[model samples]
Target chain A: MKKLILATALVAISFGATAQRYFSKTAHIKFFSHTSAEDIKADNYKSTIIIDQATGAVQVETLIKSFEFEKALMQEHFNENYLESDKYPKANFKGKGDFSKVNFAADGTYSVNVAGQMTMHGATKDVSAIATIKIAGGKIDGSTKFYVNPRDYNVQIPDVVKGQISEKIEVTVKATLQPLK
Target chain B: MNKKVIIIVLLSIIAIGGGVAYYMWNKPKTNAADVKPNYILPADSLGAAFAKNEDSANAKFVKDFVALEIQGVVDNVFVNEGNESVIQLMTNTPDYAVKCYFLAGESVSANKGEKVVIKGFCTGYLMMDGVQMSKCALIK
Candidate 1:
């Protein structure tokens, strides 16, 4: 009985030591497109992000339909024609980065480059972006900006409105992560 | 005579198409404040559904763009990066809570621990976060 109890305690301790995961549900993502005719932008605040401090692995997933546009028709067209959100409901990014330079025990800001595969509209592409992360008072704040081209993702835009939409769209991400229990 | 008729028909079609394009570019969105809620429940119930099965909960509550009137205790009230007021409601789980993002020009007047009703469109459940509602309006 004594040996069994000792083994159980050891297992528990090992599990506790491996709890180095942080997560956030309210991450924000904004995409902006600039054209000579108009500037189009949309925001999606319901994003799921997970960061493994031990392995420096990061994953982010968000619903495509959650993006809100200024105009209702524009949103509808984006869903029905451009993105086909009904067919492809979510966009995700998975990658690994180096988090060794920053000490989680200390509060400070760190800049790191994360390379990952971004999958959207049923197409996947390699992407790398610089992330600014701040650890303050037990909370982690992170933000990054990247550019994506719709053509690369197989998103076709009608020629009639080609000049009204920019070829490259700028995507910005902001998240506040808390230690997962 | 046939060529003249064809030209008039083509001209009318072009004019109609232009009018439609103009309207689509300027269509008004549905105001969440004005619509009747499809579901009126406590915060705990909604949270429980997602906690039980996230995938099915999303299909039922999230995809349809259902308007909800959720009553719960205010956990935290703060302004987000966009300067929009956000009200978080307490749930059964500490890690998950319902967050309501108020529409622009709307403010959160409720204090923490106070019970209030918020109406908005349910976007979906963020895996680690609780359910999210956007364009929320405070109900008196």
Candidate 2:
């Protein structure tokens, strides 16, 4: 009986370690803007995420000023005036979801929603994001997209130059989530 | 010699005055039509719809444009502010000048005696000097 108990404890510890192992740093983030006059796009969001399997939790963060625009001045104004990257430099999304329910015997599709606080421009809002995970060849792929507005975070503009900026800004995310080996 | 000096002075004065007049005549001027019509988010207004209090009644009520007849200062221009509003755009282009993109809202003036229609989004604003604006635009 003691031998069996020791074996069960060892298995539990091993499972804990396997569930929360560190992952390789390889993920991508992008954003796009559309307007009547022009459809401008910037894809330079550097992102990082830390997942804790034991606690069923995850944390994701990316810089706003990293977005590259066609014009340097607009980029400057974007960080300084619009998004205020100086005041609110980073945009973060951290939430919890379950990963243990996978029916590993047969590979298939699963949908999950991560509900947490998305902090941007110094404002923390409760955001529920959906993730579509596709499993194949012992690897997992994930993707998500959402929208944001400048005014929500207190980024303000004056009246004189108001015509140059759009009302709503679109933010999108795509990443290849891989488990720790 | 005195008479010649006086005559030269008079000619020089005439030449300087003529040049000044010509320069003034050729400088770029803006008429009411030259002042373009566009959207501008007001400095004092409501915030965006996607805001955290996104469901708040105030956010939905803040209109994008305010129509009226008055003079206001927009980029140092003094024209009859039209019924259409003004809004600002976010850009890095070299003063694509008036090619500014705007939000839909209204605003107070930087100065007086200027006419305009300000269009912009409402946003919460707080400054180090205790200045606050409920709605502000990202005017280019």
Each candidate: what lDDT?
0.84, 0.47
Show the colliding residue pairs in model 1: none
> Model 1 chain A, poorest ten-residue lDDT window?
A97-106
Candidate 2 local distance difference test against the native: 0.47
Q: Candidate 2: deviation at residue A178, Å?
A: 3.6
TM-score of chain A of each: 0.89, 0.80
| The candidate that achieves the highest DockQ relative to the unseen native structure | 1
Off by over 4 Å in 2: A21-24, A102-107, A158-166, B1-140
Question: Candidate 1: where are CA atoms >4 Å away?
Answer: A1-26, A45-48, A84-89, A104-111, A122-124, A134-141, A151-156, A176-181, B1-24, B27-30
Q: Write the per-residue lDDT of candidate 1 for residues B1-140, one digit (tens) a residue.
A: 69999999999999999999999789776447777898999988888887888767767776445788999999999886666688999998755689888764567798999999988877666656667777788885
Candidate 2 interface CA RMSD, Å: 16.6
Query: Using Cα atoms with residue i matched to residue i, what is each candidate's TM-score against the true structure?
Result: 0.75, 0.50
Chain A, model 1: TM? 0.89
